[model samples]
Target: MYTALLHQYQLVMSSREAVFNYLDTLKPEDLLKPVASFNNESIGSLMIHSADTYTSWLVNFARQESRPFYTADNYKDLASIRATFEQINLIVNDFLNHFKDVLDAPLTLPKKEGMELTLSPMQLFTHVITHEFHHKGQIMNMSRQLGYTPVDTDVIRF
Candidate 1:
């Protein structure tokens, strides 16, 4: 009895799994190599940032909790990132499970410059999923520039 909203949640999770599978193909050190760009964001940093963004917008903000962002020391390796992401998955799953009846519930989101935005759970989930792929491109490009070809992270096949 999966509702339309539940399907969206499943699809977003599948999309992330596809990207992480692509990440697993690279050498562990390749994660740290610098990308040949002005931004100076390495693959690891971009990935961690993407995860942190999800935690921020989806988990913390949605829960009204203020937690510090992730750091290299806290999420040093692929395993660590996956573990943290798994925790995020749990949080997201819990939210979706209990709130399935109110997927349309409006959440008050605080923004910079003293702005507040009201968005439905569906809207926030979409933002986080898209935000992830935007950074996925940076990580993919950084890996290419670092001379380590990776499996295609493009094409949301799921």
Candidate 2:
């Protein structure tokens, strides 16, 4: 279980690094350019939303010791979105670095709605990475529609 959890963490980190590299290549104007399928949402907004969702998940995980899970409020502005992305990156890195501290701990996370349920640290970690991949797909499609070259970060490519 420990080795599996470590592998999951590495996958999440690698995926994030790849996506961030893609994000870094965007020009400032590119961040705000509207994408067709996303109801004309800027690429930055999608990035921010993804990061916010992950951060909210982790924050709830850390704060509500007995709570099952929680969802984040919708992001409204660029500043908030950027901050959330930064926060998510920082928090995930911290959690990864301190895996030993909570590796064996039981987590009570929220399920579909406000319902609470128990999970292992490894399960939660896996969810975090998988969740990110799901959103990355959305962003990739949006990028292609917007005439931008999407980064290829598929696991098989690595």
Which number leads on lDDT? 1
In angstroms, the error of model 1 at 22 is: 3.1
How far is 94's C-alpha from truth in model 2 (Å)?
A: 3.8
Top candidate (TM-score): 1
Candidate 2 C-alpha lDDT tens digits along 48-74 = 656655555555564443422222332
lDDT of 1 by residue, 6-99 (tens): 6765676676677678778878887766666827766777877877887787667776777678888645667887777787677667767766
The lDDT, on a scale of 0 to 1, for candidate 1 is 0.72
Task: Evaluate model 1: give its TM-score.
Answer: 0.81
Which residue segments of model 1 deviate by more than 4 Å? 1-3, 154-158
Query: TM-score per candidate, in order?
Result: 0.81, 0.65
